[model samples]
Target chain A: MSEIINVSAIAKVEKEKIRKRIESFRSNGKATPTLATVLVGEDPGSVYYMDMQKKVLESLGGTMLKLTLTEDVSEQELLSTIGDLNNDDKVHGIMILFPLPKHIDEHKVAMKISPSKDIDGVNPMNIGLLASTSGGIAPCTPSSVVEILKDTLGELKGKHAVIIGRSNIVGKPLIQLLLREHMTVTVCHSRTRDLKEVARSGEVLISAMGRPKMITEEYVGDGAVVIDVGTSELDGKITGDCDLESVMKKASLVTKVPGGVGTLTTTILMRTLVDLYEKSES
Target chain B: MSEIINVSAIAKVEKEKIRKRIESFRSNGKATPTLATVLVGEDPGSVYYMDMQKKVLESLGGTMLKLTLTEDVSEQELLSTIGDLNNDDKVHGIMILFPLPKHIDEHKVAMKISPSKDIDGVNPMNIGLLASTSGGIAPCTPSSVVEILKDTLGELKGKHAVIIGRSNIVGKPLIQLLLREHMTVTVCHSRTRDLKEVARSGEVLISAMGRPKMITEEYVGDGAVVIDVGTSELDGKITGDCDLESVMKKASLVTKVPGGVGTLTTTILMRTLVDLYEKSES
Candidate 1:
């Protein structure tokens, strides 16, 4: 049986560290760090995700200023709201929930977020810094993956890491992070020819392709560390890319779906909020 | 026997296109596009590189504003120079020659360049744009590599491309570019295990690691398209990462060092100048 890694266990320890940091800020008479979250077109998933984040930030002594816009909100209106939050001294970090209405140019809105306040790391400047120098606020999902990998693998140098996916949010940034740790990374996407052969070669394999239960034991190597960043709804439950039971038979360790990368994402967001807050203060 | 690719043949064709574009700009009563090159400390290599670019731009009917600074120039002084160029209306693009000085922070200087005028694509915003959306002005070297690949292969989809080296300028950005072409990309570095084996897996192998003639025939897969982006000085001559004679025995195609990626780099620089100039005009 594979050692099933639960992110809640990791998040528990990280929560303690975040609490202490928040306490330090309070002791220093600094105002609580604030995250201004902009949501357009109330997608149920986005709504649930934001609600979960609100609870997480409150638990850690941070503030989430939720701004809700209708589905028909103008692009200029959304940008204006982002500008307001950007200028507001109370806002320490800013996050714009993904999947905005089709009419709104997502890239334009993303580019508008100040790098200093870009907690989710959607800003091009932050993304570029992550690529060019591996120094910047990385996207929360990718950052969570690195945190989990660090907690699990310790030293990532010289490892052949194969990632299944080429997403801007997860796979791409993760490649940069792993490369920074001196890992040789191979990114296999939909266009990859021999997916199984390439996937099996990784000492460390990460799947973020969002295809539910697509990766099986056949795709895994012996004693490989598997990280599933894929989240899909299958049979009304959150599912990951890996076939857990099948993958367990071959892998040494595999992260659980619902509580794996998803669980730590909130904790990492709070950590980023603290980081942006500190940067603003400095 | 392998076909050796020469960039001059490709550049000759591209130069005609540039010439006509310049003619169109002049016909419309637009002032010639100008590239402001900031050169600090008289490094022979950098000076030579800048002079070549100057000649290339002049050939394309563009202007080169050569800004020379002394060796002992302060960081603030260099940044101030970049700031002035950023605001200059006549300056369509700004390029800072490498190896500024041991004392100056290169990253800081790179960040100071405006993304709009960052012709070499060193600015974090541009880098982020490339990584995130594949919609930014990329670095000249990586852009040159893409030009060669596209010119040689025509369509890059689904091919396995293995790149050696993970420099900010070449490897990282090239991975993004190749990935944008829907090619499965793998990056190897000094820390990569079984470098030759990993390198041999690619149908298209690119060497940007500045180790002179490090890639041998054993590293090249049969009929693999090889692009040598590595340029190092060997016995007072420019050398590439490939053992050309040995690689030629197995590879279907190979690029020459001095006349390979280097020749097209100037054309691409002029191309980027035209792009930035056009953007500024619009």
Candidate 2:
């Protein structure tokens, strides 16, 4: 039986530490560490994510400010709201929930947020900083994967990490993070030829392709560490990028979809809020 | 004999096209495309690069503004200089010559250059923009590699490209460029295990690690296209990252050190200047 990497349990422990730290800061009369989220056109996924973030933050004595906007909100209006949050002394970190309606320019909206306050790492400076290995705050989903791997396998050095996505959000940033850990990283995307052959070669494989059950037994090498970063809905059931049943047989360790990386992201989001807050203080 | 990729000849062809375009614009009484360069503590290498840039720009009827500073220039002084250039209407592009004295923070210096005028693509925004594959304008050296390969191979789609350096200036940005071309890219560095094996895997191999003759015949696969992005002084002679004499025997197509990627860079710089100029106009 494969060792199912307990992502939530690990996140729970980390959350406990954050809770104590937040309390310490609060008792010492420091401004409460706050995460302000801007949501445009309510998405079930986005709502769930925000709910998770709010729960994770408030439970640790941190504050969550959720500003839900209509789908038809003009780009100027959204940018104005973000501008306000950028200057707000009480807002330590700001997250813009994505897919901000077709008419709105998402990249422009992302860039408008100050890099220091961008806990989601949406700002180009944040991604560039991550690429250049200059700063700490990385995009949450990628960081969640890193945290999970760090918990399960102490040191990632020399491991061949093959990521099955080339997204700005996950695969690209994850390469930088894994490279920092001294691991050999390879990124495979939609155009990658002989995908299964490439997938089987990874000592540590991460799938973030956002396809349901795309990775089967053939993709997992014997005793390889597998991380699924993809989440989707199939027939009203949650599905990940990998086939958990088949992957479970050959994988030495694997992260299930809902219970794994998905759970850790909101927790990492909370940690990022605290980090951004502490960074502002320092 | 290996097929020698003539980077200089190709650049000349591209330059001619740019020259005609510039001439047409000049005939219409448009402002001459201008490039402003910031040089600190003039190194011999940097001097040569500047000279080449000047020649390239003028040959195409563009103007070059060269500002030389002393070694002990304060960071504030440099920032002030960049600020002036950023606001200069005549300056369409700015290139900060390498090694900005020991005092000035390089990243800070890079960020100071306005992205619109940053022809070198050193700003985090430019790098971020390149990585996100939104709009073009990549860092010159990396873009030069893509141009050479695109010219030689016609299409990089589905080709396996392996980069031998992880520098922010080279390997990281190159990944985005190649990925944009739909090529499968794998990056290897000093810590990479089975170095020879990794290099051998590249159908299109790029050596940018700045090591002289490090990639021997053992590193070159059967009929691989080798791109050497390294330059070093070995025995009072210019040498590239790969063992040219040896790799030439194995590589189906190869780029020579002096006449290879280096020659194309100045032309690319010129293109970037014109690009920034045109971007401003549009």
Candidate 3:
């Protein structure tokens, strides 16, 4: 039987370490780091996610400032609110929660978030800096996956890493992280021909395609290390990209759906806030 | 014998098109486009390249403004000079010539260049936008290479494009451009293991590693399209990363040095300026 990896366990330990570091900042006479999240229109999923994020930050001894706006809020009003938080000395990080209303231009709003306070790494300036050099905050979910991989596998240098998806939030940013580790990286997407052959070729496989149970036994090789970043809703049930039952049997290591990358994202988001806060201060 | 692709021939035609377009803008009572180039030191190669850029812009109905600086200029002074050009209404595009003195922080200076005026696309915001979405100006060299390939190869939709460098200038941005065309792209750099195997695996091979004659016949496959972006100064002579004679024999098409992507870069810079100007005006 292959190794069933526990990413949440690793994240728990890392989260405590971040909390300890936050304490050091506090002891040094610095203000406690604050995260400001902007939510446009209260979707059930986004609200739930924001609440979970708030709880995670509180547990880590950080503050979560929720800025809830109506769906019909003008772009200028939204930008004005975000500008206020950016100038707030106590605010260290800002995240615009996903699924902003259709009327609001998401791209324009994302750009308005200050790079220093851009904890989610959605700003092009922050994202560009992350890819251009080793600078800037990495996107939360992918950063967590990479942190987990680093902890699980000591040296990723020269490993053949294959990613399924070319999303800015996940696959694209993850490619930059893996490349920084000197790994041979290949990104396969929907238009990619011979997906199965490409997936089987990698020693480290990452799937962020958001398709439920898309990666089957046919896509995995013997003893491949698989990281599933997919969260698709099917019949009101959440599942990952990889087929847990089959991937566990075929792969040497696997992260399960509900308890794997998903669980760590909140903690990772909080950790990123602390890191960005420290960086901005220094 | 394989086809010897004349990239300069294609570039010449495109340059004329841009010149004609500039004439139309002139007739419309608009001011001529101007390029502002910043030179920090008196390096011969940098001077030569800057002169080439100047002549290209002038030849294509544009103006070039050279701002020479002392080698010992402080970072603040350099940024101050850049800030002036950014606010200058006549300056449509700005390019900071490479190889600044060791004392200056290149990254900080690059960040200071305004994205709208950044013709070379050195700013991380532009690079990141190019990568993250289908928006923003692409770096000249890579954008030229993609345009040449698009002109030569009718549809790059399903082609396997491989790049042998991960530099922000050529390889990284080039990967984004190719990916936008729906090609299966793989990027390999100096740390890539089994370089020869990786080179032979792709149908479209690009070498931008800046190592003279690094890619020989053994690294190429039959009927592959080879684009060399390397320009290494060896024994006071310029040569590409590809062993051109050997690669030409193996590949179906090849872009030769001195007349390949390099020739199209200046024209593309002017084109990007016109594009940005139009975008800003609109």
- The top-ranked prediction according to TM-score is 2
lDDT of 1 by residue, A1-282 (tens): 689887888999999999899999999899999999888887999999899999999998888899999999999999999999999999999999999889999999988998899998888888888888746888889888888888998998998999999888889888888898899999999989889999999999999999999999999999999999999999999999999999998999999888799999999999999988998899
Score candidate 1 by TM-score against the native: 0.96
Looking at model 1 chain A, report the run of 10 residues with the lowest lDDT sum. A130-139
Q: What is the interface RMSD of candidate 2, in Å?
A: 1.1
Which lDDT tens digits does candidate 2 get at residues A1-282? Answer: 798898889989989989998999988999999999988987988998888888878888999999999998999999999999999989999999997799998889988999999998878878877887568468889999999998888988877888999988899889889989888888888988888877887889999998999899899888999999998899898889999999988899999978989888888888888889999998
lDDT of 3 at B22: 83
Better of 2 and 3 by DockQ: 3
Show pairs that collide, candidate 1.
A128-B128
Q: Return the lDDT, model 2, position A147.
A: 92
DockQ of 2: 0.70
Docking class of 3: medium
Segments in model 2 whose C-alpha atoms lie over 4 Å from true places: none
lDDT of each: 0.91, 0.88, 0.87
The alpha-carbon lDDT assigned to residue B246 of candidate 3 equals 90
Compose the digit string of candidate 1's lDDT tens values, residues B117-209. 999899888889888885788888888888888999999998999999999889988998999999999999999999989999999999998
For model 3, the stretches where C-alpha displacement exceeds 4 angstroms are: none
User: Which ten residues in a row are the worst by lDDT in model 2 chain A?
Assistant: A128-137
TM-score result, candidate 3: 0.96
Measured against the true structure, the TM-scores of the candidates, in listed sequence, are: 0.96, 0.98, 0.96
What TM-score does chain B get in every candidate? 0.98, 0.97, 0.97
- Better structure of 1 and 2 per lDDT: 1
Residue-level lDDT tens digits of model 2 in B135-228: 7468889989999999999978988888988888888889888988988888888888887887787899999988898889999989999999
